[model samples]
Target: MKKHIKTINGVDYLGHNALANNKIIHIKTTPSSSGKTHFYWNKGRAELIVGSKVHFPVPSIAHLERYRESFFDVGRNEIQIGDSIVWFFGKPIQPMVCATVVGARRDKGKRFLRLQPNHPDSIVPETWALYQPGNFFLVSNNRINRHRAPANIIYAAYQDELNKIEEIYAPIRTRRIILRYLTNGNLSMGEKAFKECHYELFKSIYSWAGQYRKIELVIGDRQFPTMHPSKVEKAMREFCQDFSNRYLRLVGNDRAKMLNALVYAHKELAWIHPFEDGNGRTMRLYLELVAKTRGYGFDLAASLNSKKKKRYYHFAVRKAVEGFPRILTALLNKALT
Candidate 1:
């Protein structure tokens, strides 16, 4: 029989992986005076009124030991206090899907994974603390071992957003490395290349660079509920393989089809939002590859964020959600020609 999901005080923690999206609802497992053990998740993004039983550890898993392989490989290294992890929701028959690790709590020698707050870890990791709990509350990427905040940072409490610094051109350093790798001729631009590109672009900024986003997010008003974190890798791989195979083989004056393909490519990247950050810039970079193959270039408008243009861009992206690409096609058509 399948393993029963772990719970504290009869609260079902493992419902769906998406439930742990951006808030690492870190709960403390405690023993009560009546000789019973109960849980209180009164820290991090979700503060459960001290004695309420309303949360999960890694979401959808009653216990982590049942699927030992998925939690970490054999002889797992010291899982750093704040390192990101992929939690497996071992669905029967259906292939297992993953959730991002956001927080962790130690209970008798086991590091129970805490998922990224349904949202957190924005441009700055410091901003993520409010969404996470426990000693995993961090400084930049390193988890703070001290119970209190750093002496230098203001409001360095357990639940404050990190300070924002200038946009330090994280892209320039990453762009250089990716360009060198791409020009090597042996690499066919596909999902692997996309992964490589994402890694090179943001590894300097965050450790979990190439991996998929750990939580689900909405771009505009639409939630896109079905687009959960676990499905990110599969969707991206399929897209990369299919698009590369076709685009690479096409020859002759297929400009119309090529532009349409460009629209499709852009739409797919935006639709997925695969990486944590740089999805927009990454989409453009990927489009540039598609263009490079066709002996031309694709450029996203610098002023694309202006009210007039962002509205249309957002509308086109939303339309792509429903598989309608005419408006988006026109936009790409203009950029390519």
Candidate 2:
């Protein structure tokens, strides 16, 4: 279960592998004779159906049709894997909840999916009180309720809630655009390709979303070399040509060699700091594409889920900025296959 996701103001958005139809859901389940868990979808609760009939008002599988539809939004914009959904009940304690679509399946005439919750073990008994459309304004509200879901999604409710929510989900929308490129016949990987995706990620917010940064910037005490706004075009040209060279040079999976190549490309891109804010995120996406060149799934899930590893990732990237890329190479090597 490789997971690539991040939480903004407590809302989780999927930014990883293309798992179709993921969302946050609250349901009860019971042991069915088939050994797989039978989830109770109605009433926003579920329990394992133990015995055939134990005098409980067990809802029929027919009733589950409605609940299943609510939990998983089918037939709505081709629901890719990393997309997110929120279900809020307008309560204080645990008013709003979000989740991602992890996996999907089709049985008989129905479609089913596996949803990964955005909560942790600390809140094991997490319950989402789903808000109906009447109480909330979903981003998808005016856009047609094609998913047939029972819950209303509101990603942010804090200050500048709508804008913040858009920022949070930007990765999702951007990832979709990149996914299309990856799956499309056009197999180009270079600065322009990355810029297109970066633009999608930060388009609504930044005027220079897709373009290279002007002037210069620093990270803490480290002042990175950023191209002057005027020279960005030529620098990017050389950079992309060099990237293509390195990618073409990738050979049989000598793990260390492959990793070194991967680390070098990422290090070079980050050093360029191509775009202002989304350079890091877009680079992560580019690295995934690089890994794909060698049939590796460098998913964000196993990469960003750990506090310790995140620190190490930063450390490795810093090492890459210098000449010492062994750490970053080693980290990326571990993520392969």
Candidate 3:
């Protein structure tokens, strides 16, 4: 039988992964008798209140164990403070089980509560923290730790990259580039290869580059090439014109609307495969620019990968050909959110 966990009188504290149709879970905890609560996560520390829910997933047995140790694991199954309850599950536990009030303790100058159904006692503390949700472990596991850089080093690198772009470009465009770089690190150019290219120049004219070259571009696992050079040029021109017109209509001069327009416009442009080589890179960059213009920030590089790429590309194609923006919208929403 599969074991699942749930929490009562608590809020979700994090979101961990997007695998398996948004494989997400939550960290829910109760307040002290005085009604004070603490929030623990990798980014953006916040205060917890009654009735607040933060949903996230615990990815594996090891991750669950780590969470137990970090929060509770005070050499007991049940930990209580005031009127609140904290529970932990073991190897017999499954993703569906909700932990109840178990136990509490203080270690290394911090206080934590423990839950129940204790597994082996050999689980390490480092692994214990890996179980909390909200893209933290996956991002750290895949990129941060894989790169073997210290936390400060990683932050510095990201800040440096942001600074380089900010020095050379407008804030809006800089923000976009930052978002894209955060999401995916790779960038490609079709034929327009030059250093220090202005964001506007690339935005306005990159689609038309290499249009005269009679080549084909195919994405995902489709049986046919999605676009041929000759067809792409004509389609792109029409797409751009129509997109600009739509931008004016749907958003009607609102900056946020304009940014959303830009995202959709880039999505449409990507569908056209207007350039031979750099469509993917350009589309991502374009999306970043739009997002920055709208006061939104995201990390695309940290989210997408070779394993997820195939599904993403397939969704894009489906959006373009089937007149179904659901898949495309879902992807962009995921990125933006």
Give the candidate number with the greatest TM-score: 2
> Candidate 2 — which residues are off by over 4 angstroms?
1-167, 221-231, 249-258
True-structure RMSD for candidate 3 = 17.6
Q: Rank the candidates by lDDT, best first.
A: 2, 1, 3
TM-score of 2: 0.48
TM-score of each: 0.48, 0.48, 0.35
Return the lDDT, model 2, position 256. Answer: 63
lDDT minimum window of 10 residues, candidate 3:
135-144
Span of ten consecutive residues with least summed lDDT in model 2 = 40-49
Model 3 Cα lDDT, one tens digit per residue, 59-135:
22112212322122223332322112112222332211112222233447554433221122212121222222221
lDDT at 60, model 2: 27
Better of 2 and 3 by lDDT: 2
Ranking 1 against 3 by lDDT, winner: 1
Model 1 has an lDDT value of 0.49
Residue-level lDDT of model 2, residues 53-116, one tens digit each, is 2333332222222222221332343332223444333454434444434334345655554444
Task: Tell me model 2's lDDT, rounded to 2 decimals.
Answer: 0.50
Candidate 1, residue 258: lDDT: 80
Task: Using TM-score as the measure, name the better of candidate 1 and candidate 2.
Answer: 2
